[model samples]
Target: MNANVLRYSAFTTDPAGGNPAGVVLDARGMPEADMQRIAAEVGYSETAFLLPREDGTFEVRYFSPLAEVPFCGHATIAATVAHAEANGAGEKVLHTRAGRVRVQVDEQFTATLTSVEPRMAPLDPDDLDRLLAVLRWHRDELDPALAPAVAYAGAWHPIIAVSTRDRLARLDYDFDALSGLMAQRGWTTLNLIWRADADTFHARNPFPPGGVVEDPATGAAAAALGAYLAHNEALPADRVFRVHQGDDLGRPSRIGVTVPEDPREGIRVSGTAVRITDAANQAG
Candidate 1:
């Protein structure tokens, strides 16, 4: 089956910023191998393939350069905006590998994804130690308020909250070592964060699992962080948080997060998308 692939950056209005994703408008009859090949050929961290549904929604699948993921926030954001433009901006239901996700595009072009139910689990001490060593970080650098844990919102990420922004900025890690650990633990990425205030945060994601050193804007990890914050009651109910990410990578990105009172419903992450120049549409 021939599929058309489009590129767009999610969570930022700038064409050069945010997380870039490949979107397939029609993916009917495409095999897994073809999808994987297309994603790798596109060379984006993740690519989205949409299977249009009869009810005006679509079935979406996410593939990284290396493999398929359960769900991808940035890709979903990108796909939603693309769909809205091709179709119309409104509510769309996405059936993903992880679960059902509902995306809504506002009049201002901000796409918000209401995640699936999120959960968190304590990380084993040994795993945390190994991860810290891989990043060449000492245990003392960790924020006491935010304990290290494994959080999940469609994908699993090891959350490490740093006490200072400087510590988060200097993000150098042993890629091979960290990648090995993530592979062993089945982790999707490492969510490194610096809290700017009770309602604002700065984040960086090490996505060795996706064969990428860093993700410019990570919507899945942002959703996971929002779940963590709400579980701990770290922020007020009326607060709407902002996450600044990808600054150190030169592709500055901003993610908006809102934590509702209900813990059962997943977090809401909003961002705009901008279409960049069509890359040589090289689909394998």
Candidate 2:
């Protein structure tokens, strides 16, 4: 197994500010067990393993510390950036477990991933109550405009919009309880958010199911948020927004989101990634 993993932080240019993801540019002979073990050893929220195909497209898989997830946005960004850095910037088609993902890397090395067709589902009231209980949040604390729902781009994320930024900042929750509930419901993360304005938002994601307490920047969740906003008819004129995350964790990240006019089209998530050097990793 000649798996060479490169570390990169997505959603930020600074290595220490965004979410770190392990990228294996080539994993031709690597087994699934080895991928899972490598992910665990990397100790990041997620790691991306790419197997290059004969036709230029790549087959990709994402593994967290605990299990394999269908897709991961941050890892995708990190992996593609790492690929662009080595092979020069351009487009790549990724065959993920969820669906086909089209990623484009600009000359400046900013990677934008267009997710597979997004969908939204109603959040069962009983399930919402259980989730709130585990999160230690009251019903009144939620934002009235953005109703809670399960949104899926590649993975399922429950979109919970809080009324205040302070509420979003205070993110203490029952780890075991939330993890059990997420596993039962097949949710990747809880997309807890606060709308700063029409075009600005603040987000915090709890990823207990991935064996991580929180995700500094979550591209999948950002895509889900775009879907949620479009579904609720709450999107701005241009249907574009910026999401600021990881402030509470001290590793700030910025994610750009674009929702298409047609509901059938997938959401577009754009971000930059920086390679994590040995010194930077040690400092972090």
The most accurate candidate by lDDT is 2
Q: What's the C-alpha lDDT at position 64 in model 2?
A: 95
Model 2 vs. true fold: TM: 0.97
Candidate 2 residue-wise lDDT at 246: 92
Backbone clash pairs for candidate 2 read none
lDDT of 2 by residue, 1-284 (tens): 54678999999999889999999998888889999998888899999999999999999999999999999999999999999999999999999999999999999989999999999999999999999999899999999988999999999999898899988888899999999999999999999999999999999999999999999999999999999999899999999999999989989999999998985678999999999987222210
lDDT of 1 at 170: 91
Off by over 4 Å in 2: 279-284
lDDT, residue 146, model 2:
88
Cα lDDT tens digits for candidate 1, 1-284:
45678999998888888999999988978898999999998999999999998887789889999999999999999998998888788998999989999999977778999999999999899999998899889889999999989988899999999899989999889999998899998899899999998778999999988899999999999999988887777875574799999999989999998877885787898999988775765475
TM-score of 1: 0.97
lDDT at 120, model 1 = 92
| Per-model TM against the reference | 0.97, 0.97
